[model samples]
Structures are given as C-alpha cells and as structure tokens.
Target: MKLEMIGDIHLGMALNRKKADFDFNVKKRYPVISVSNIEEEGYFNNKGFEYFPSTELLSKKYFTEEGEVLMRLTHPNTAVYISKKQEDLLVPSYFVKIKITDKNYLPEYVAWYLNSEETKRELQKVQSGTRVTSTSKKVLETLVIKELSIEKQKRIVDLVELHQKEKTLYEKLIKEKEKQLAAATAEIMAD
Candidate 1:
C-alpha cells in the first residue's frame, strides 16, 4: 500500500482546456461528453452530449483515449474511465484529461476512487467560485491518490462494475412494479 500525489503519477499533468478556438456553432460527427453525463455517483453512464466542432489540434491537443481518466470541473468533480470504445470522442474544455503514466495504477480504478465519497469531500474543500463552484488544475494535481497493487485495483474495479449492474436491476424492478400498480389502480375505477 502506498499513497502518492496525483501529480507524480501522470505523463500529462491535468491537461485542462483553456483559450480554445473551437467554433461552437459548427456541429461535428461525434458528441462531446458534458457534465450532465455524470451521475450522482460520478459514473459517466449517462449519454449526455453536446454537438461541437472538432478542430485540428484545437491547439495541438489530444482527444480522449483508452486508459485515460477525465474529471469534470464542476462540483462533485466527476471522474470517468475512457474505455477503448469511448476513444475518439471529443472531450470538451470543461473536462481535465488525466492520463496516468504509472503502470502501477489502473485508470478505471483511479476514476472509481476519485468518485468515492472520501475524494468528493476532499475536493469540496478546495472548490472555488461562488456560482459555478469549479475545481482548478492546481488542486487536482495536488490531490492524494491511495495506491494499491495492480491485482487489487483490478478486483476493486470488477466489484464496482458488478455493483453498478445490481443497481440497474433494482431500478428496473421498481419501474416494473410501478407500472403494475398503475394498471391495478386503473382497474378499481372500472369495477
């Protein structure tokens, strides 16, 4: 077990979008992930997106890639893992792309940890601005990340995926029950 500041583990140190010349009026073929895509748990499961034009470089910049972690600047600082399938999608300026260079850490696990309650509280303390309440690149780089062996990180990620699946199932069950109850209530009036 080890603890390291986020700055020491990455090749790219909190690559945030700033002063980009992208034209918002132009629509691109792909959708860029927005803050709305993040759920209460900070999982990027929702398909929220905004159409934005993709520019060459956008300042010689990189797009989202597999094994990369993205953190939303807004409150809760939602962090998401970039799977192979999610690669090629444009990450908007509001997101700070964190690519972990350390082989000891897995991006999925790192993202999961960032979204954890402990990290959330830590980030809340460093938040800036009165209205938007966003996090800065400096704070992100200074954040502490608890390190575990690669095997343990993998196991933890697997367990989280299973838990997410369970939550989905429970939500479906509740919706089905609600439908059945509504139908039954309608029958009472017909009797």
Candidate 2:
C-alpha cells in the first residue's frame, strides 16, 4: 500500500521549498526543533532545543503547526509529531516537515507509520552515502505504508502512546530501585 494509492498525495504534499535559513552560532529567542529534540521513545524533549537566529524564518514557511509531522532528513529514522495546541515551532534543515493532505489518514498516523520498522527498512533501501546514510525528497514522495482505516490508525496511535507512558514509568522505577540498592550497599559496607 502506497500513499498515492489512497488519494492525490500531491494535494496534501506541503514541502516548504524555501531553504531553512539560520545561523547555528547565533542563539536567538525562538526554539527550533531538531532531530535531537525527539526523545528515545519518540516524544518531544524541549530541554535542549536549538534557537533559530532569524525570527523571519519563524513564519509558516519554516515552522510546524499542529498535527504536522517532522522526519529526519539525514537518517529518515525518527518522525516527530507536532501535536501541541500552541503556536508553530520552527523545524530545522536536518528534518523534513510533512503535511498529510489525505483526509482518510490522520497526520499522527502518518508520523507513527514513518517511525515504524517497516518504513525504516524501506527508506534504508533508497538511502545513499556510506558514512551518513540519508534518504532524499524523491524517496519520501514514493514511500509506501500500510493503508488502514482511520479508526485503526487512531487505535494504533493510542497504543503507542500507552506503550511510551509505560516505558517512561518503567525507567523511573528502575532508577528508584537502583538508588535504593546503592544506599543499602553503602550502609551495609559502613557497618
């Protein structure tokens, strides 16, 4: 199942042809979301996002609105969904911003699908460069994904969110257990 098979992908395809302009050395007020901003569990972590030097770049041209999907252009492995109900966030050049035009499929579904192992494998096949493997715009345009009902997509997204929450709680639990173990060991050794 391919994206084109569902509907007119070109209609939904919204690639800001304008090149991302920002001076990395110059820090500014606006926060820019890079690939690193995405956490290990495929969630946004704004603790250390970079600042775009140009406020002019923040205009709809370079920023991501709600439900917009941002994928890593270099590796094409991570797809971070902009689901926050707030002002647009700037997306840097390292990532490709995708706007799903198809009403049948939700943007969240597309983001989740892009981050799936199957999609990664397919992207890897067309990626170039031995040192830093990367997929191109053409590759993204022709990418195939399993076509499913909107309801199923919603359920999948919900399950993934639940799994992420579980993973986060599990990590915290492990950390607390480790601290307890360390303190107990120290007390016993001192005795």
Candidate 3:
C-alpha cells in the first residue's frame, strides 16, 4: 500500500511593520525565513510578490533529534515554503514533514518528484482560496505519485546524489579558477 503525506498547513498572515526593531526579533531565532530573503523567482502565485521586506518571518524550532530526522528526509537542494497561518498559531512553517509510504519509493526520489515543474503546476491548481492561496492535507494526499520498484527507486536516489556531488566539485573548481584569474590580473596591474 502506498500513502501520500502532506503537512505544514497554515493560514497566511500579514507582517506587522509597525513593530519596532523587527530585525531584532527575528535575529533571536536560530533559523528564520524572511520575505526579503525569498527570491521573486521562487515564489508561486503572486503570494511571494505581494509580501515585501515588512512581511512576517517564519522560523522552525526543533529538538536536536527531530532536526536531524528532518534534514535527513528532505533534499539538500529542495526549497521549503512557509505559510502565514502557521505563524499566527505560533507553529513553525516546517512543522509538517511529508513522506510517502510506498515501500518502493526512496525519500530522495519522492523529494525530487515533488520539486519538479509538473508537480508544482498540479499543486498550484489544488491550492484554493482568494485572499491567501492555501493547500490542505487532503489536496496533498491526492497527488499522483510515480510507481516504481524499490530497487529502481534506490538506484535513482543514488544517481541523483552522485550528480549533485559532481556539481558541487565542479563549482569549487570554477571558484578556484576565478580566484587565480583575479590574482593574475592584480599582479599585471601592479607591474
């Protein structure tokens, strides 16, 4: 039996700009997500656009063990969106961690599927409400998940991780090359 899981449902809340020293309040948290830090490109359905720097920030508080489990479950490159409703309730936006129950599906494989463009479009459609577009647990449960054998799922996960590691190595090499070039330019100028 396969089960689709969705969590982190919350109402959108407006940021209170009038509060003195808003930055001070956010700095108190260990991990925080502010509207300003969220790039416009990543925002879906104008919600991210509507809110600016003054918008309320979301933070996730976790015990050490719970935090480790969450970091392990989610992909390192995946982005997590916070909801305003969760803020009002004093709940962390990352409170809900989703996982599929399919024995064949590896966690990484499922994460990649959810992060794909096609899945995002489907998610947008299921999101309801006018003032603030929100998704419920039911909506996530109905998502169409790919069916694959456990062996295949693990293989895919391994391949994706390998590619990611390669990309990181290449990025480091490029940065080193850039630094060398800069040094050469500076030496030429000095002479």
Candidate 4:
C-alpha cells in the first residue's frame, strides 16, 4: 500500500527565526527537533536541538503527537515513530512529519519499514541532489509498503526492541571488561 493512503506527510516548520527571539533563560523554551536528534536505533537522541521563540503562531500543527512518524529530508535520511509525547519539541523544516489517518497500519510498523534495508535501498536509488541529497515529496509518496496485521507488527517491534536492549547491555559489558583488563595490567606492572 502507498504511504499517503495511511497518513498525511508534510514538511515541518519552515520559519526562519533568529536566536534573539527565543526565551533561552528558562527551561520552557520552544525546542526545535532536527534530523540529527534521531539515532540509528530508531529513537530520539535528545541532543543537538535548538530552541525557537514562543509565539502565538506555535499551534498544534508545529508539535508532533504520539503515533506520528518523522523522516529526515537530507542525506543520511532516517525515520522515527514517536511512541510517547515529547513536550517542548517542534519539528523543523528539514524533516517530514507523518500523521496516521488510517488504522490499518501501525505507526511504529511503518517506521520500521522505512528504516529497513529494503526501503533504504529503494530511497538511495531515486534520491536526488548532489551536495544535499533528498527525496522529493512526490517520489516519497510512491513508495510501496507491505501491509501486515497489527498483531504481527507489534510482535516484530517487540522483538526488535528486545534485541536492541540486549545489544546495549553487551556493549556495556565489553567496555567494563576492557576497563578491568587495563586495571589488571597496571597492577601487575606496579608489582
């Protein structure tokens, strides 16, 4: 099924405002989320975001809701599905925000598909530009997505999450082992 059939896809805030307009003194500054904040693991990295000036124009259209999927338009393009509400973060112009309109497809599942190798390969083939490669809105709309049952999507997402958690734990363990080895080497040299 085509992605447009499942949801609406549009660019994020295109306003070009200066830093002087933002209220950076307080913790409630309007945070602008960029493509750099999304990690390869399909989660928000919570880093490298800039704040925008709060204005009357900051409507519901600027913020992303739960179940919304975000895709980067620039090179190294990636997609992430928001499972929970992220307060103070507004989607920026370089990212595309997709809000699901149909119940047949899960937001997380669609995000997973977008991040998959299959989709990435497809995108790499047709993506335009030289310095800053990006997929056109029209081209992106034509992507064919596999239709899967909600139950299976949930199961797959769960399994992927589990695998990621395990991978993180293993990385931590390896770092600890390396530290221990270094300490042991130092102790032997001192003796």
Candidate 5:
C-alpha cells in the first residue's frame, strides 16, 4: 500500500516555522526533535535534541506517539520509527511525521521500507537543491510502499536485526585477529 493509504502524513510544525521566535523556558521547556536527531539507519538519536518551552494555545495531537514515523526534509533525507516516546518532545518544522491510522499496515514495516535502498533512490530522484537538497511535503505523500502481511514484516525486521548483530561480532573478531597479527610481527622483528 502507498504511504498515504496507511494514515495522516504531514509536516510536524506547519503552524510555526520561525525558529527565532521560539522561547524556551527552563522550567516548562519540552524536548524538540530535528533532522540530526534521526539517524539515516532509521533509529532515533536521543543525544542531540533541544528543548522548547511550553506555550499557550498549542494545538492537540502535536506530539508524536510510539509507532509514528518521522522523515527528514533536508539533504540526505532519512526517516525513523518512534519506538519510544521522550516525554513532551515536539517535532519542529523541518520534519514530517507520518501517523499510521490504519491497523492493516505496521508503522515499523513502513519505517523499514523508507530506509531501504529502493526508497532512498526514489527520494534522491525527487530531491532538489544545491546546498541542501530537500523533498517537498507534496512529494513525500506520493512516495509508494508495498503492503506486506504483519507476519512477514516482523520476520524481515528480525532478520535485519540478526544480521546487524552478526556483523558487529565479525568486526570485533577481525580487530582481535589484527591485534594478534601485529603483536606476532613485532616479536619476530625484535628477534
């Protein structure tokens, strides 16, 4: 199913675009997420987000929930699945949040697809800009996604995670081997 078919997808802070006007209060401030807080590998980076103070007359449904997907609009566009919520965290104007309204499609599944090579290539095609490439909100809605059974989607996520773990272990083993080889060579040279 196309991304649009699953839920309401739109820019996070369409109502407020000016960054200079923001007022952050130390006592009442809320954490805010930006493109840099989202990793290209499709995960959230909790380290770099800033906080914005609570303001009067904020609209409802402004904050993202667990399972909602966020996509960056700037160059090297990337999306992340909201696995957990950082309390009172708000997404700013530079990102679009996709709330999966339908139960048929899994939000995690869609996030995985968005980070895949196929989606990346498609995004690269539509992105325009020299200094900072970007994809428009309208263009974002048009991006396509395949519909897969929940079971299949879960399996895919599992496989990818397994591969990642194995890759880490292999890298560690290689490093250990390299250290051993270096030590052996040093000893032989000394002799």
Candidate 6:
C-alpha cells in the first residue's frame, strides 16, 4: 500500500518548541517505550504534574483535548507542527487539509508516522522559506508515507489508548496519595 505525507495545518502556531525539547529530555531520562511527544502533547494542559518521570504513571488530564480534535481534524497521514516564532506575535490563522487515497493505512498509524523525528526532519528539509520555514499544502501532499496493515494500525491505536488509560490511573493514584500525605501531615501538626 502507498502512503502519503502532509504537514500540520492550524492556527495560533501554538507549539512550544523549547517546552517540547525539555519534555523530550525528561522522557529520555526516564526512558519509556512510547513517543515522548505524544505523551507530552497529551499532558500539555494537565495541572500538578510539572514533568513526567519514566516510571511515573500518567493521568488523563495530561492529555490535551485540543490534541484529540487536532488529530481527528487532519487526515490520518498528516503531520502537524506548531510554528515557533522568535517574538510574541500571533501567527496567521491557517489550516491545511490533505486527502489520502490509500486503503491499507489507518489514520492513527499514519498520524504517528508523520509525527516521528525522521519524518519531521524530512519535512524540514522541504521547507523553503527563510524566516518561518513554511511548508506548502502541495508539498505536504507529495510527501512519502510507509504503509502498514489495518490490523497493525489498530494495534498501534490500542497501545496509545492503553497508555492514555494508564496515565489516567496514575494521575488518580497520585492525587489520592497527595491527599493522604497532606492529611497525615496536618494530623501530626495538630498533635
């Protein structure tokens, strides 16, 4: 099965590259099996957990609601990049949508592939602009993709979902532990 590649098309240029790098570093330090970016993106809006430890369980709150929407909005084979700007400036609103013709690939698998480092570097290579290194819709449409079977695609999606559940359970456990710790400390202080 043939695969197609595409760029992220969205407004706000909301991707924080520095934060992404930091998260990536932390993930490497902890050493998890899943992609750090996916974990980070999922945990972006979550409160309390400043950084995720490798063995530290994840919570549902860490997963970004925006990410779900963004993931669904784009074609499965599309890769999205949040623009990095030098100064505090609002990025122009734009969304690029591409259609994929391949039947063997699932959208979730394709999305993961596009988000990989190797593919990101390739997309960067195609960038022509000086200041922002913008990627055009047409360029994205022509990008190459590796095709995987439907069963494999479903398995990947399942793994991602499983991680999400684990993250949620961890979050719940952590919150409970924090509450218990606080109560115990308060009781001791009262004595």
Ten contiguous residues minimizing lDDT sum, candidate 3: 65-74
Worst 10 residues of 6 by lDDT: 81-90
Writing each residue's lDDT as its tens digit, candidate 2 over 19-115 gives 2355553333566675667864567754676654552333555667777777786775687677864236666666767766678888778878888
Query: lDDT tens string, model 6, 1-191?
Result: 22333223333222242123445444322111112222332221223223323323333222332222122212222342222211112222233322333556555566566666676677777766665456655555565767667898789768866876888899899999999999999999999
Candidate 5 residue spans exceeding 4 A from truth: 14-27, 46-48, 54-57, 163-191
Pairs that collide in candidate 5 are: 1-147
- TM-scores, all models, native as reference: 0.80, 0.81, 0.53, 0.85, 0.75, 0.48
> How does each model score on lDDT?
0.71, 0.69, 0.44, 0.78, 0.75, 0.43
Number of the predicted model whose lDDT against the real structure is largest? 4
lDDT of 4 by residue, 22-122 (tens): 45533345778865678876777647677676544466777878878888877666888876755546888788888878898888888888889988899
TM-score: model 1 vs. ground truth: 0.80
Which regions of candidate 6 are displaced past 4 Å?
Answer: 1-39, 42-95, 124-139
Sliding window of 10 residues with minimal summed lDDT for model 1: 6-15
- Cα distance off (Å), candidate 4, residue 144: 1.3
lDDT per residue for candidate 3 within 134-187, as digits (tens), equals 555565556676867878877876776686678668979999999999999999
C-alpha lDDT (0 to 100) for residue 124 of candidate 6: 72
The regions of model 3 sitting more than 4 angstroms off are 1-91, 128-134
- Top TM-score model: 4
> Which of candidates 2 and 6 is the stronger one according to lDDT?
2
Candidate 6 collision pairs: 8-80, 42-62, 42-63, 43-62, 58-167, 59-167
RMSD of each: 4.3, 4.6, 9.0, 2.9, 4.2, 14.8
Report clash pairs, candidate 2.
12-101
